[model samples]
Target: MFWVVAAASAVVLGVAATLAVVFWPKYPALAFQPLADPSRVAPAVPITSRFAAATVRGDRAYFASVSDDGTLGVVAADTGTGERLWGNPAAGDADDWQQLVALPDAVVAVSAEDDDRRRMVLLDPGSGKPLWDRVIGDDDTLLYAEDTVVLVDREEDRLLGLDVRGQGRVRWELKDPGSLSGSRTTTVLAATTPEDLAAPTSAKGAPFAEPLDDDRRIVQIGADRSARVIDARTGAVLVPPRQSVADPDDPVVAHDGTLVVAESDNARRIVAYDLAKLGEPRVLYTAPDDNTRFEHLTPCGTDRVCAVQTTSSDAKTAQVVAVDVAEGGRRWAWPLPDTNNLVPVGDSLLAAQNTTPAKVSLLGADGTVRWTRDGVAARLDGGNLLRFAKPLSTYTDDPSVAGEHLGDDAVELGPLSGVRPATCAWNTAVLACVADEDFVLRRFAG
Candidate 1:
């Protein structure tokens, strides 16, 4: 009777698992899309100075530095017209500066000689004048989107939304999820019911619960080690997290409302949760075997690509395999050797290979080599120039025009030429990485 009951339970669990997959948000299988042939070239523009730091936003650029005479200097570039909009380093406190974000309208500056003196400043991109300034009490996680900056206070466990113009507002707040070994280990902090929660794994082999979400969503892991999703907006349980055949591993957020969580227990498989709908997660892609480990999985437009290493005795290489989140399929694959970094350029992948001297390889969605340059670090800019380090080389995606542009192409600026890229915005712009050594900002063209 015991044996019969055990078999019956196993069969029932298998059926439930199959039903869960069928009811989950479905996506297409994986397939490879071909790429176009690549063109190789180097920049012809005159080289200039070296920069301590640099970044590219939408179409404008901002660079800041302390001059020899103890003054700050800033340089701005118009990405659309390729003109220098503003080039003045004499803005802000000349002594110390840091944390620049290119907003839609203005550039924000964070200044502090020490951690206790943290201050944020908003500056006009065109005029280089301060708009608003505020002293955030703590060093919080700041997210800049359109007009709002999302600041998360980990210590207080609160969320604050501030206007780019220095208007601070409290969006929401929640208690800390608590330590894994706390008394509320299996207790649900903000779920609909006990069954609606999923358990998170602990190093002690005991599962704990973590309260993770904002005002719109709440997630909890249960004692059984299941992950569950809850809708904070409606206070309803949507996706009931399940224990994977694999253990809980890395969880990544996709461009769309998808949560990609992976486990490598029994095998190498990843489950992608489409938050748009409440159901089981679809198995997006699986590795060849347990030995194939994941390096990085990043969003490429609406879809995503996972870089995996197939282990062998010979020289191990990295392959970027694209996965469809909505349709549930594989799109294409790009084989990369020395794939140091993969920067997304719109719908394609920009693979950076650091050889003996380092080089940039631009690959199309179809796996074709669009362009290659030697001894330069390159990044895609607005479908036009591949911003290379050193004497900046601006390569055109248009093959016919590429030659013409290359002729006119001189990295007009050098390393210190100070052409920090800016994101063109309407009202507030942000510059990242502000420090006493260098300041970077994004400027709006208009």
Candidate 2:
């Protein structure tokens, strides 16, 4: 009886050992602690009022916005601070304001009553204190690059480039300035006509949109739709041949020195101009149908172009295609429904609906829909759709009404231009222009 009892005890011990060995946790054990109740998960904190524009700076977020009456407010916060950051630090009323641009060392707040009375105010992100304020060009033509700002004299047809720091002299002004726009890292200033215009014409009538490559050379888009690569310091034209641009209205320069232009003339083709081999055109496909009209073309990294094709018969449906600019071939194509407008959001595409603002959907290079956000619009960086809830009293108004149109009375925030950038910082997954009443600087999962 004693041996049987001992043998049974040993059998039980062996079974227990086997169970423990099979179910043992690894080096990183299951250290998770359950909440008091199964339903007691942490609640999501949604963004709220008083924050303006939220831009990424290094690892933290820097947000800026206007108050009830055009006052400037700036705040900085980190994701480590639970779901939200500390409140804003800078707040004050201004008569009129332009846009907030992020610089390498500081943020620039441009305000003006008019172009002749424009002010470029620099602020330190840490303190939101005013570094310096200077009068730039007249209000009619104020353009911003990363660190540089260009002021154009509309009446005189001249260009003045200023370093926002106020410590350096203004760079050389183009005597016969044409059309210009600012990129994320560089400035594009093209001299279209040497002679001054009696009346302002559309920017398309102006000459090339040159990529101001650093401070060394100013790349030109020539009269024949060619790229005139010029030495920035010496003013010598490098390549003089005109490129066969498909869509002059929508042109993008790739990293490999290839120029991709939308074939607006032919909605089915994208014409590529190689800077290395000028005068040659590479053709890319858009859709099977020829009558389809192509609108927006966002670049995919340094090579491919994201094409948004529109059909006049079906206003709601859009055909999106990916084109390899170098090889001049179609990568893939897919049809998306209920899209009013198309914009680039991070690495994916955003669909702006006329009835319901805008939302994002991640589109892969192989034409796959990865993720999507439904019924939310505010890709504010492209400058479309003002964050203000109420429509502006007029397009020329200084400040906007927040929650006014959507049923609240808060300060107005923008007369925001309807332009979006091709690329944004890596940390920024989605950017939205929300009504100022619903303003806060916070992070959300992509």
Candidate 3:
């Protein structure tokens, strides 16, 4: 009887050890070490009325709030110390401050007064002083690049480019309606001329490769499924409409100025075109089987692109493929099972698996698993940091908390107090998010 009891005791101990090894990492305190003291959290900012949008740039956080009196105000606060930088109640009325875009030295706010009138106002980032204001037609769509802003007037079918820093000076304008597509830093506009419009195939069979300055051209796709490279400054048609089977899935500009498009030809493939060389499309990697389709492509680093390839009929069979942008070959591929969300964090990929006890995995650019954790909601803050969230309590009054960190082995920032439904904007850093409970914008940093 004594021998039998000893053997049973050993089995129970072994099971307990195994369970600890598997589940202990889920505890927030063990997986993450708090970077900021919970007791030292910043005071909440009062936003009693309607909150439209917010942006964080550099060291300041800017947000727009509407009061009970129907007046609109833009407020700026320091992210680190939570100090108010400036607040402009009369900058624009509630009807006038509909959209806000943050620039390096200024903030551009858009207002639609009526169906026929729209206003674009550029204000000093530090002082909220009006730098310049321009009234555009209601049919126009405003787009921004780092140094330039563009207005696409769909009704007038005109494309206007203006210098963001200058006094709203026109850089270039073209008459094209549906052929404008590019990143925020670059603009590509395309359309057939009146003569070419009558015979849209006039410029067909054009070669895809031509030597042109990438800095001066934006590659656009036409309604007829043709590719055209347009001059960025002079509005010249650098590469006229060319016949191609490429469909823009997710186009990204590589470090060397090559426009990489995740497209489908005979099979889903990644194609790279040097806007400078405009040569033959370099086939990067073709999907291994007909079942796989490339869904998204983002820059992994300076010289590689990361693509999420999913099976057509199964959500569980998804994988990430990292390809060398210069060599047009695969560097590594990692399988992500039951993953419903994928985003790029720094040079890595964050995959959120849709399983019970929810798991998150971080993958390096070389397809190695850096770390995996469970029991949190996460998203990339448009930078190198991972923002995590967990429900504070089951009661309605209990806030849903969030924090941001580098996602390394031993880094954690928040589980910031009194924050719920937080939204973050990312450039080189994750901007602070305004807490829905108190409307206080909290910044998380390591």
- Candidate 2 — which residues are off by over 4 angstroms? 1-51, 65-94, 112-118, 126-146, 150-159, 166-168, 175-248, 251-256, 266-268, 276-279, 286-290, 312-314, 338-360, 370-373, 377-446
- Model 1, position 118, has a per-residue lDDT of 54
Please state every model's RMSD to the true fold in angstroms. Answer: 17.6, 14.4, 15.0
**Residue-wise C-alpha lDDT for candidate 1, range 39-95, written one tens digit per residue:** 111111111222223333455555555443434455555534435566554344533
Cα-based RMSD of candidate 3: 15.0
Give the C-alpha lDDT of model 2: 0.44
Error of 1 at 233 (Å): 14
Scored by CA lDDT, what does every candidate get?
A: 0.44, 0.44, 0.55
Residue 442 CA displacement from its true place in model 3, Å: 4.9
Instruction: Tell me the tens digit of each residue's lDDT in model 3 across 167-198.
Output: 77888877652345422222243221111111
TM-score of 1: 0.55
* Positional deviation of residue 178's Cα in model 3 after best superposition, in angstroms: 7.1
TM-score for model 3? 0.67
